[model samples]
Target: MAITMTKGQTGLTGNAAIAVAMKQINPDVCAAYPITPSTTVIEDFSSYVADGKVTTELITVESEHSAMSACIGASAAGARVMTATSAQGLALMWEMLYIASGMRLPIILTNVNRALSAPINIHCDHSDSMGARDSGWIQIYSETVQEGYDNLIQAVRIAEDERVLLPAMVCLDGFITSHAIENIALLEDEDVKKFVGEYRAQNSLLDTDKPSTYGAMTLPDVYINFKHQQSQAIARAKEVVIEVGKEFGKKFGRTYALFDAYRLEDAEAAIVILNSAAGTTKVAVDELRKQGKLVGALRPRLFRPFPFKEIADALSHVKAIAVLDRADSMSGFGGPVFNEVRSALYDADKRPKVMSRIYGLGGRDYKVKDALGVFNELQKVLETGKVETLQKYITI
Candidate 1:
C-alpha cells in the first residue's frame, strides 16, 4: 500500500529528504566522500546504515575520486551503487566520472551545487556540474526539496532503462535548498521499489559464464565508436526521462515535464531559469501577470540532453526571453542556460529574441522582485528593439 499522510505533516530538510529517498531505493553499495552542504546527505545515510535499517555496504572514502572509483567497482560487480559530492570534490572525480558513464554503470549521484574555489568558497553555483556537463551524464536540476527527492528517485529508472544505460546526476542548490527545511511528502519504500523495480545489469563485468573486459584501454578506431555509442545512449535517455516522470506521477500525485511553463499560455515575454530560482520566478511571474503584463517563467527540470525541442516549442509564442543563469560562463559567450536557450531556438521558425542575465553568484539571495525586474527588462526588449548583454544584481 502507498504511504498516506495528513495534509499538515511536519517538514524535513532537503538533504534529509534526499537521504530518505535514497534509503527507499536500497542501494547495494554507497561510497561517499564529504563536502560542505552535501556532507549531511551522506551523514544521514550513514546513520541509517548504523541503525541496521539499511543493509548496504557503506564505504567511507578519503576523497571523491575514490568514492566514484568504489562505485564503479561495486557496479561492475552487479550491485546498484550510489554516491554524493559537490564543487571541487566533483572536479576531483572528473576522470572517473567519464569512466563510470562510458562503462555504462547506473550510478546515481546528487550534486549540491557549490561555487568552485579560487580562494576556496562553499556556496551555491553551477561551475562544478557545468564542468562535467559533457562527461556523458544525465543532469536534472531541482527547484524544491520535493522535486529534489522526486528527481533522485526517477534518476535510477532513467539511468537503468536498457535503451539508455547511463549514469545520472540530480542537482540541487547548496545551502540554499540542500540545508533548508521544507515539508516534503516522501514515497513509501514499497512504492519506490515498485517504481524502480529490480536492478538487472546487462553486460556486467562480473558475469561468470560470459566474462568481458571492463574499461580496457582502446585505440582511436574503437574509442571513437565507443564515444559515439555513449552519445546515442544519452540521446535515447531523453525519452526515458519523460516516460519515467509520467510513471512517477501516476504512482504519486506530482508531475513535472522537461520544461514547465507558468502563465506562458499567452504571454509576450518570459524568463527562463533553473533550480530553486524557478520558484522565486514563479511568484514574480504571477505578480507581473496580475498587473496586466503578459509575462511568464520557464523552468527546465532536465538540464542534460537539454530538452532543447521542448524549450524551443514552449517559448515559440513569446516575443522575447530573458535567460537567467545562476553561474556565469566567464571565459565563453554567456552563462550555461543562456547558451543553451540560444542553441535551442537557433533553428526555430518563429524564435523569440533572447537575452542573458547573470545573477546569484557565490550563493547570493535571488528575491522575487529580482525576477519581476527581469520581466520588466524583457518587456522593454520586446517593445523596443534594445536589450542589455548582461545585467547583474538589478536593484528592484
Candidate 2:
C-alpha cells in the first residue's frame, strides 16, 4: 500500500510527534509502561488505541521490565512490536534488551533520553541510552522534534530489515525535545503505512509447521557463535540503515545519513557532538565562520554501529577537534561519545588533535555561547599545536 503526506506543517513536541508516528505505522502491538518525559509518548499512543485510530494492541504492563518482556513475546509471535521509556525505565529493561536482540526480534523502542539515578534526575542526558550501547540494539539518535518523528519511522524499517533483525532504540533528549514543540511535517497515514510497509517476520515461534525454541541457553563456544552472528548482523545493519534512509528520503522530503555534518568540509577545526546540542554547536560553527574561522561541527545520527571510518574521514582534514558529550562516561579519561569519536580517528591519514568536553548532564543548558567557548578552545589547540587539557568539564 503506497502512502502520501500532508501539504502543511504543524507544531509538535518530540513525544507527540513520535506518538503520532506510532499511530501512523499502527503496529500490531505496543507494550508500554509510563515514565517521566517519555510518559506522554505512551499516553498519546494509548489514546489513539482507545479512539480506534490504529489497530495496535496496547499492552499496559506492570513495570518497565515487563513492558520489554511483553514486547519480546509479541515480537516472537510475529507481531510488529514497539514501546517507549526513559532513564530508570530504560535501565529496567536492560535484561530483556539483550534477550530481545539475542532472539533477533525487531522491536522498535523510542527512548526519551534521561539521566540515570543517584541524587535522582528526571531531565535529559545520553547516559541512559549510552549505558545500553552494547546491549545489541540498533541505536538511532534524534537531534530535534522533526528528526525524532522521522527517525522513529525510519527505525522501524531499519530494525525489521531482514539483514538487521535486531531491536532498535530511537533516542531523543528527554524533556528538552520531549516537551518542546516545533513545526514539523506530518505524513499522510496511508503514505507512512506505505513507507513502513507490512511486517514480514522470517522466523516465528508461532509457526506450528516449523517449531523452534527461543531463549535457550547455549554452551560455551555455542554462545560465542551466537554472538558472532549478532556481530555480523549489527555490522550489516549499518548498510541497511543507509539504504532505508535513502529510500525514506526518496518518499519523503527529508534525507538522513549516518551523521549530520555542518560546514565540516575543508574545516581546520571542528566539534563532534550528538542529539539536540549539535544544533547549538552548528550555531557556534556559523558564528566562527563569519569571523573567517575555518570551523565546523559534526553530529552523529547513528551511535550504535558508531560509523567509525566515515566519522574519522569527515574530521581528518581538521587540525583540531573537540568532542562534546552530554553524559560523562566517568572512565576518568573522557565522555562516552568523546572516547568513541577519538578512537574512530586513530587510523586516520592525518589524525586531528582530539579532546573531550563533558557538559549538560541532567538537562543542563548547552547554549550557543557554551559551544563558542569550546570552539574558542579548539582554535587555541589549532594555533598552539597542543591540547592544553585533553579532557575536561565544560559547564561544571
Question: Cα lDDT of all candidates, in order?
Answer: 0.88, 0.92
What lDDT tens digits, residue by residue, belong to model 2 across residues 130-177?
999999999999999999999999999999988889999999999889
In candidate 1, stretches whose alpha carbon ends up further than 4 angstroms from where it belongs are 1-10, 390-396
Candidate 2 residue spans exceeding 4 A from truth: 1-7
Global CA lDDT computed for model 2:
0.92
Best by lDDT: 2
lDDT of 2 at 305: 83
What TM-score do all the candidates reach, one by one?
Answer: 0.96, 0.97
Each prediction's number of clashing residue pairs = 0, 2
